[model samples]
Target: MTPSATPEPSPAPVLVLMATLNGGPALQEQLDSLSSQQHTHWRLHVSDDGSTDGTLDTVAAFAKAQAAHGRDVAITSGPGRGFVANFLGLLAGVRDDPAFVALCDQDDVWLPDRLQRGVEALSKGPADQPGLYCSRSWVVDQDLQNPRISAAFPRPATFGNALVQNIAPGNTILLNAAAAQLARAAVSAAQAVPGLPAHDWWLYQLVTGAGGLVIWDPEPTLRYRQHRSNQIGANKGFGATTRRFSAMLAGRSRSWTDANLAALRGAAHLLSPESATLLEAFDRARRGTLWVRLTAPSKLGIYRNGTLAQAALLLSLALRRL
Candidate 1:
């Protein structure tokens, strides 16, 4: 008889970090979705903000259930700061395991293939180089019915566009060990800088700026929940797009840009020379006249996804709202 073939070992576990605040209602569904993932080699780390609801109890129960399946799950107190900071804390809490890390929202259903697809795509890059994987998401209502696929952005994820707009959605992100380590270091360095932007946006900038690869998959792998209290949801229809444009006109977008720029500048040591030059040009354009703003961005090769959105950017510059 032939000798028994050696069994293939399981791959490194993907670390899924989720931060919660009063997540009782939908937390169970999200956790169940994770349990159903096709990628079995994974662990969950949840950071909970102080909750009056039964969120912690729900997480505890789910953790106990998952433990029987040989999956590791941990629940801990979140950083007292808001959601963005809470996420940063979770990212920093990851150990030096040379594993991929995924960001999870408190209330979303991951498809069975989400983790598997992310890991497969990220594995294509050199392990020594930083890699980021993000995908579009299916926008769903509260009950997870009538799902509409999110529109694909035509604009590429260049450093110039990354400086101003964050096309990366946090829940859809997967970062390899190298990228996660770089992000942790950037987060630490930017702590002194007040008003840092969202963790996903910052990571997009940091990775692209450092000459790392950011793969944007057109295929979605999760259901993005849209509800009353969504911090950020799928940018889908005309209404959503218009609201974003209005925000730019209202200076809200500019404020976010300013904060992001400050954080980028604070972490300048990590940026590649080309990215540094792009950042400088963006800064100068922001302070220049309408003609200079238009001319400078063109030279820098920055653009938003849609033609209309790109036109709006130019209009914002001309109006001095950018």
Candidate 2:
């Protein structure tokens, strides 16, 4: 993604795609972060999920201003689709020859090296393993007072694990064209499976399930924000987010239930045959047909890998807290 490597007319520009809703509060901070990215050879495409607020107008103005300033920023209407659909639609809309596609959120602030580092990682794998390269993030808030993070990235990830639980946040995802093609195809094929999770997390599973690769870079290259209006669960500190999750479990927050469960089931189905031991344990634990409940500790941790122990720990905590 060097500044001088121009798109040779035959292809579409390397694009940065963002799916935004009522994100007006921190839109400019996101825009500025992109503007300051270390790589300058990319174009920006936005799919607005019908923002009732000034979100759409703000992005329009920002693009226009950037255009006036000679930067490559573009905006488009998203037909009022929700977050997941708009994300899929935006990437699918990229009919142009895309070398790579990066996901951006309107609220998070990215470090300057995200795109550049991701490009390097993808380059190492080549078209053979074109899944996605993602890094961990420093989960923060608007004020950036408290940052909660773990050494989660640069860890082993595959389709099986990904289907069960998302490893990297969406904002840290960067995929090459071949991987993007595979992702689009998987989404189209998953029509039968309607209740999937976030498009970013789902795409990671899809690409890997198709025999692609996922590489983690371990660096916290993005600032993930948490707020009361979060669509899913927010990324508070280990203690804080966990305590809040226990509360949500008590309340049985609908959004969190739908998103997380769908993620678990989907990830479970992606396990390879070689992963049958872990896979069987995960599926049985997740499957509700049985009288028993799942409580596996994921190989990764208490929350990830969709293991029986992790699930059990979560339920145990919830039961105690509730």
TM-score of each: 0.96, 0.74
RMSD of each: 1.5, 6.0
lDDT of 1 by residue, 242-282 (tens): 88888888888778888888888878989999988888888
Error of 1 at 168 (Å): 1.2
Pull out the clashing pairs in model 1. none
Cα lDDT tens digits, model 2, 189-245, are 443344444777767666665567887777888888777765654433465456645
Go through the candidates in order and give each one's C-alpha lDDT. Answer: 0.86, 0.65
- The candidate 2 region of ten consecutive residues with least summed lDDT is 293-302
